[model samples]
Target: MHPSTPGSTDQHVLHSAAQWLSAGSPVWLATVVATYGSSPRPVGSLLAWSADFGMAGSLSGGCVEEDLIARLRAGQVDGGQPQLLLFGDNAAEQARYRLPCGGHLQILLQRLGKDDLAGIQQMLAWLSSRTPFVREVSLHASGQRLTLLQHDSPQTCRLTSEYFIQPFQPAYQLLIVGAGEVARHLAALAQPAGFAVTICDHREEFLQGFDAPGAELRCAMPDTLISQRFADSHSAIVALAHDPRLDDMAMLDAFDTRAFYIGAMGSLATSAKRRERLTGLGVSSTQLQRLHAPIGLDIGSKTPYEIALSVLAHLLAERPQRS
Candidate 1:
C-alpha cells in the first residue's frame, strides 16, 4: 500500500486474524453494524480482536474502539450471540460516548474459528481477482441469523444489523515501456506508492542498469509484452523511450486494452511527428489524442528524476479523493 494511502482496515483485520491463528490463539471479528448521519466508519468496517494482539482495524471512531480493545483484552468474551455496540446519537449513554458528528453506530463482534479464517482467505482470493463480492455469513444464535454484506459496495445503513461497502482495489499496476533512466526513476517512485510496476525494453544495456526495487524488468518485444500483464481498471501504461518503433508498438497494443493511462515521452515537435506517423498507421485523431505525449506534467523538469516526479504527479492526480 502507498504511504500516502494506507490499505483498508479490512485487510488489516484479516491479517490480525491470521496472526492470531498462527500463534495458536482465538480471534474475534468486529464489524460496524449500522450508522446514523455521519459515523467515521460506515457499516461493515472491520476490527479483528485477539487475546494477545488486542485489536486491528476499527469498528468506529477512537473512543468506541478503545473501549472495544479494553474489552477484548479482558478475555472472558461472549460467543454464539452477536452484541450491539451503540455510540453517539439518541441514547443518553451513547451521547456520553461522544462519537464524532453525533452519529450513532452499531457493531457486531464475533469470535472467529479456523473455518472463519479460511472464509476470509477466500474473500482475499476474490479481491485479488478484481471482481466485486458480497458475503452472507450465517450466524446461528437462538436460531440462525443470515447477514449479507458487499465488499466494495456503495450502500450504507443505520441499524447495527447489516449493510454494504465497496472494498478498495489494491491492483493498480504501472507498465513502464523502455528501460531507460526515466523508466528506472519511475519504477522506483511508483513502487512505494502501491503500483505494481513493470519495466520493459529489449536492450540488454537498459536492463543491466535497471535497479529500481519492487519493479519487474522484462527484456521482451514491446508490442506483445503487455498482453499477459494487465487485466483490470487500475492498470496504466507509459512509454518513456522516445524510440518510435519501440514506444509506438507498445502504445498501439495498449490502445486496444483497458489501461486507464497511456503516455509517451517526446518534445512538441517529436510528439507532432509521432502523431503524424500514428495517423499514417491508420490510427484516428481521436485515438492519437489518448496518448499523453510530452509524457509527464509540464513542470519544467530538466533531469530524469525530475521528469519521473512530474509523471508520477500526473498519475496521482487521477486518484479519487479520500474520505
Candidate 2:
C-alpha cells in the first residue's frame, strides 16, 4: 500500500511491476503460494519489487520481505531460478521471522526479465477488461516458468510438485449510492479492506457534504454508473441514500448487473416496506431475494462508524463466496 492509499490490490502490484519492467529495471515477483496453519498472509498474496523500482505488495506484512531482501542483497537466496522459500517451520524459525504461532508460509519467488513483459502486459489487459485469468507456474528441470490462461471463474490458489496455480481477477469494487456519514465511514473502512469505493449521488447539494480519501465521487444518476462500471462479478453495490427515489432507482439497475453483493441501508421495518415497494415496482422475486435490506451483520451497530464496520465485515465474509 502507498502512503496515499488505504490498501493495495494485486492488480496494482502487477501494474507497478509492469512499469518497472518497461523502465528496464530488474524486478522480482513474490507470491505466497501456500500457507499452512495460522499464516499471516493468505495464499495468493503478491509482492513485486525491484532494487530501484521499490516494493508494491506484502506477503506477510511482517519481517519476511525485509529478511528476503537482505538475503538477496547478500547473495544468499539467489541463483537466477524461481525458488520456493519456507518460513516459520519451527519455533526457532518462527522466532527469527516473527511469524504467527503455528503459522507456515511457502513463497514462490521468481526473477523476471524483459522477456516476461509481453505476458505481464497481456495479463494486465485482461484485468483491465475485468476478465479472470489463471497464472500457472510450472516446475521443470531447467527452472520454474509461467503461463497465463483465460478463465471464466476464479479458482483456488494451490501448489503441487509440478505447478503453483492461482486465479486472479480485477480489483473488487464497491459502488455506494447516496452520500452521507455512513457512506463516508464505509468508504474509509472499505478501502483498507481492498475495496475500491465509488460514491454517487444525484443530490448535488447532498453530494457536497460527503468526503473520503481515495473514494471516487460522482454527482450523476446511478443507472449510468451501475450499468457501465459496477456491472461485473467483482463489484458490490450498496444503496445507503435512505431515500427511496435514489436508493430504489439504484437498486433497479443493480439487480440487472453481475455485482456479487447488493444491499440497502435500513431497519427491519423499513426493509420490509422497501421489499413491498420494490415488488410493486416490478422487481422479480429472485431479484428481491438478492437484496440484503438491513444491510450488514447483526453486530448491534449504533454509531455510523460501527454500522460501517458491520457492513464491511459482511462484505468481507461474503466476498470470496460470491465473487
Candidate 3:
C-alpha cells in the first residue's frame, strides 16, 4: 500500500512524477482540487501514484489513497480522460474512510503520459526559481493548460463546476540565524512543516558537527546572507543567536527584505533594549513594528524544544491558509 504524508510539497510530488516518467513508468496525478468541512489536506494538495512506483504525495491523511489505487488498478480509471473523484459525500463513505465528520474531498485524477514530462519539468523550474504559476484543468474531461502568474498572484486554488485552477509557488523558507540548540530544534521541526530551513552562523566553532537533518548549514555572515538572498515574501528570518553582534546585524538586513516574518529571540526586557538600540541605529519605528521581538507565541516555554514549538506556532499563525 502507498503511504500518505501530508508534509510533501507540490514540487516533491511533481519531481517524483517526472522521475518516474523518465524511467518509463506511467504515473497518475491526483490533486485535491476542492474540499469541504474537515479535509486533512488543503485544496492544492497533490498525490503522484504509479502502480510500479507506489505514491509520492498525499491527498488525505488515511484511506483515500488505498481506495483510489484500488480503482486505478481495477482498470476503472484510464489515461484517456481526466475525472473528478469525490470522497466522503455521505455518512457511510465518511465513516468508511474515517474522514472527519462531514468532511468531503474532490480530487482531480489525471493519468500522465511521457509527453507531459516537459510540463512537469517546467513546473519544477518555476518552483525552484520561486516563480508563481497556475495549472488549470477541465474538471469533466481531458484538458489542461498552464499559465505564468504575476508576482502578486494569490497563493491558492479555486474550483468551479467546469474547471480547477491552482496557483503554485515556491516552498516556504525559514532562515534561522544561529547554530544553537533552539535553532537545531526549530530546523528539525520546520522541515516536515514544509519550510526549507537554512541555519546560518558566522562562528565556525558553533557550526562544528551540528546536525539537523535536511537543513542547509552555512557558516557565513547572517546580514550579508539576508540582503543578498532569502528575503523574499515566502521567507521567514529568525535570529536566535542572542549576541548583539550577530542578531542585530541580521535584523538590519532583514528589515530591508520582503520577508514575511522577521523575529529575534529574547526576554521582554532584552527585547525592549534591543528595540531601543535598533531605533538608535536608525531603524524607523514603522520598520521596527514588523519585528517580532521575543519571537514566538507566548507559550511560557522554558526549554529549547518548547520555545521552538511556540515559534513554529506563531509562524504558522502568521502564515496564510494554514489549514
Q: Specify the highest-TM-score model's number.
A: 3
For all candidates in order, the CA lDDT equals: 0.69, 0.82, 0.85
Estimate, for each residue in 71-175, the C-alpha lDDT of model 2 and write its tens digit: 777778664667899988898988787888888798988888887887788777877776666777765432333444445433566678987767765678999
Q: Candidate 1 or 2, higher lDDT?
A: 2
**215: Cα error in model 3, Å:** 0.7
In model 3, which regions exceed 4 Å deviation? 1-8, 140-143, 151-155
With candidate 1 superimposed using the best TM-score fit, by how many Å does residue 202's alpha carbon deviate from the native?
A: 2.3
lDDT value, candidate 1, whole model: 0.69
Q: Per-residue alpha-carbon lDDT of model 3 for 44-129, expressed as tens digits?
A: 78899988988987888769998999999998986787888899999999988889989989888999989889988988887777
Candidate achieving higher TM-score, 1 or 3: 3
lDDT of 3 at 308: 97
Weakest lDDT window of 10 consecutive positions for candidate 3: 1-10
- What's model 3's overall lDDT? 0.85
Candidate 3 local lDDT, residue 187 = 94
Reference-based lDDT, residue 178, model 3: 86
* RMSD list, candidates in order: 5.7, 3.9, 3.3
Between candidates 2 and 3, name the one with more favorable lDDT. Answer: 3
